[model samples]
Target chain A: MSRRGLLIILSSPSGAGKSTLAGRLRQWDDTLQFSVSATTRAPRPGEVNGQDYYFSSVADFQDQVAAGDMLEHARVFENYYGSPKGPVKTAIESGRDVLFDIDWQGAQQIKNSDLQEHVLSIFILPPSIKELHRRLVSRGQDAPEVIEKRMQKSWDEISHWDGYDYVLVNDDLDTTEDRLKTIIAAERLRRPQQPHLVDHVRKLQSEFGDRP
Target chain B: MSRRGLLIILSSPSGAGKSTLAGRLRQWDDTLQFSVSATTRAPRPGEVNGQDYYFSSVADFQDQVAAGDMLEHARVFENYYGSPKGPVKTAIESGRDVLFDIDWQGAQQIKNSDLQEHVLSIFILPPSIKELHRRLVSRGQDAPEVIEKRMQKSWDEISHWDGYDYVLVNDDLDTTEDRLKTIIAAERLRRPQQPHLVDHVRKLQSEFGDRP
Candidate 1:
């Protein structure tokens, strides 16, 4: 029988190269799934209706929250965003690990959920505040005021970094990417992630019993 | 600040290829130390004094045990065997990972020791009991009764496989060797294993503080 899958939560502040790393991880293992979050925020330009997010009405988002459909949710500014529990549960139960690209707040929620035992959370840190600011400003030509606001928000996320099982500084993209792959590959070998081992051992035991 | 090292514990039955795998692991990384256990048993053929086993007198072994120099000790049939606590404490504190090739009892004792937090235990299972028997018999032209006794002792060890953090079936030497390397590489990336990360983050914090 297939073992249960890991939550594989990846948390980082904005512009920490988490998105690029996540993309690389998926390419390395196509079986790895991205947990598409549902949000009440209007889609940004060039964003697909369902691919970027499962856009939902404010009322529907709240309804799912009330019905316990969201694995974790948060109100960020004017929008409501969350991971729906059904797809994640289905994917994990079938032994397909689901990757969550989320902030610490959502991470804490899922860690406290019933499926907490299956969660493997990691936090990524920027090499330095200077580098973080560089990436933030490099993204788009935002006004100085907007950039300042984003900087404070990024710091807010970085301050909560100590809550993860593994933390890596995104010093070099290639090094960080390779390290992430190593972490994932090793985690898959953990005892809880390989239930079929029990059967293998049982077969050996029987084989021993039948010996001369 | 350098992080503390792990006590990499590897346990398996007599003929499960644990020795070969351990040899390959040491070859893969010379810095990985083999924890030379002190035993009161007589030196076997072709075994070196310090490299193979630290052959000790029974009185000396018991004295070390009484003085608490032994990390974990156990008696098998007639002889006492144990891991010395001194070298391990020094190696780990100095950030050099130590490898322990001991039985389940010693593994459990170390897991319960003060340095339990630094322990990373793994168990190797043979692909089949028939193969295990084949390996045991193939070693020498022993009497059937001696082989039978060995088989029972091997089963005794195999029964405790579930206590390990990671368990692998030794179906192929190269595959198991690679997997062992992967486990070690990933474990090194764990949060607790990287104390210098704290300092790095503090530097980043100061970098942010200096910003306008």
Candidate 2:
């Protein structure tokens, strides 16, 4: 019998390199399926319906919340967003590990939900705050002021590190990615994840009686 | 301020490919150190001193036992074997992850010892018993009768799968090995493992004064 897939929640500060590692992990492991969150915010240019996010109206987002269909929902800055329980549950039941690349608030909400036990939480941090600031500025994505704001926000994000089951420091990109890959592989091998394979091993043993 | 290293225990039946994986992991990450077990058993041919096993004497072994110097020890099939407490403590204190390649019994003993808090148990299994049997027979070291005995022994080993905190099936050696590498890397990044790194990150924000 196939077991449900693992729910992997990965959280990291803006410059901690989790997004890159998560992307590489998905590229490396075919079994992993990314969790697409639905948000009330308007899609930016080049954002696809299913690729970037599932765009929803404010009322629709609230409706999912009231209907208890969203696994975790929150209002961030103005817009409401949530992980739809349907797609996540379906993917998991089909034997694909679903990855939730989200923040602490979202992860905490998921943890409080029924899906908490299935969740494997990981929080990633940069090796140092100097490194975090350097990486953020080097990216050239944000103005110095905006980058400074993100640095401030990182502490608030990282403060919830203990709430996660695993933590990672983005020391070097390649090594950090490699480490993420190992955690996923090891978790998949966890006994709860492979009962069928264990039974298969037993059946094979029974076939070969000790031939002394 | 260095954080503590994670104590990872990997238990698997013979020929399940843990030794190779452990070696590769250490090769990939300089920070990971393997726990060299101390034993009273005579070293086999080609075994180097302090490499394959820390060769010790019966008298010294007894002294250690009396002093409770071992994290775990046992008399197995006519030999006394134990994991020494001193070096492991030092390695962990120095901020290096230690891998324990032992059987379930040794893992249990280590868990029962003071190292339980740091221990992360992982059990590896072959994808199928048929595959495991094939691997055992191909080695050709065991006679046909001995192969049968080992296959039988594998059944007993498989029974303890539940005792592990994580399980991995060695279905594809390369893939599984890569997976294990991630597991170790991720566990090392745990929050408790990097308290100093947290402080280091915070210190940068204070130095930059919201500018950098």
The alpha-carbon RMSD over the true interface for every model, in angstroms, is: 1.3, 4.1
- Per-residue lDDT tens digits for candidate 2, residues B1-212, read 57788888988888888878888877788778888888888889999978888899999998998998998888989789888988898988888778888888888988888767778888887776667778898887778889878877887887787788777777787887777766665566666676686676566446556552
What Cα-based lDDT does every candidate model obtain?
0.91, 0.79
Q: Which candidate number would show the highest TM-score if scored against the true structure? A: 1
Candidate 1, clashing residue pairs?
Answer: none
- lDDT for each residue of candidate 1 in B1-212, tens digit (9 for 90 to 100): 46778899999999999999999998998888989889999999999987888999999999999998899999989999899998898888888889999899999999998888789999999999999999999999999999999999999999999999899999999999999999998888888888888898899788888998
Measured against the true structure, the TM-scores of the candidates, in listed sequence, are 0.89, 0.69
Candidate 1: tens digits of C-alpha lDDT, residues A27-60: 9989899999999988888888667899999999
Q: What is the TM-score of chain B in candidate 2?
A: 0.86
TM-score of 2: 0.69
Per-residue lDDT of candidate 2, residues A45-130 (tens digit): 99998778899998888888999899888888998878999998888767788999888988988888886667788888677777
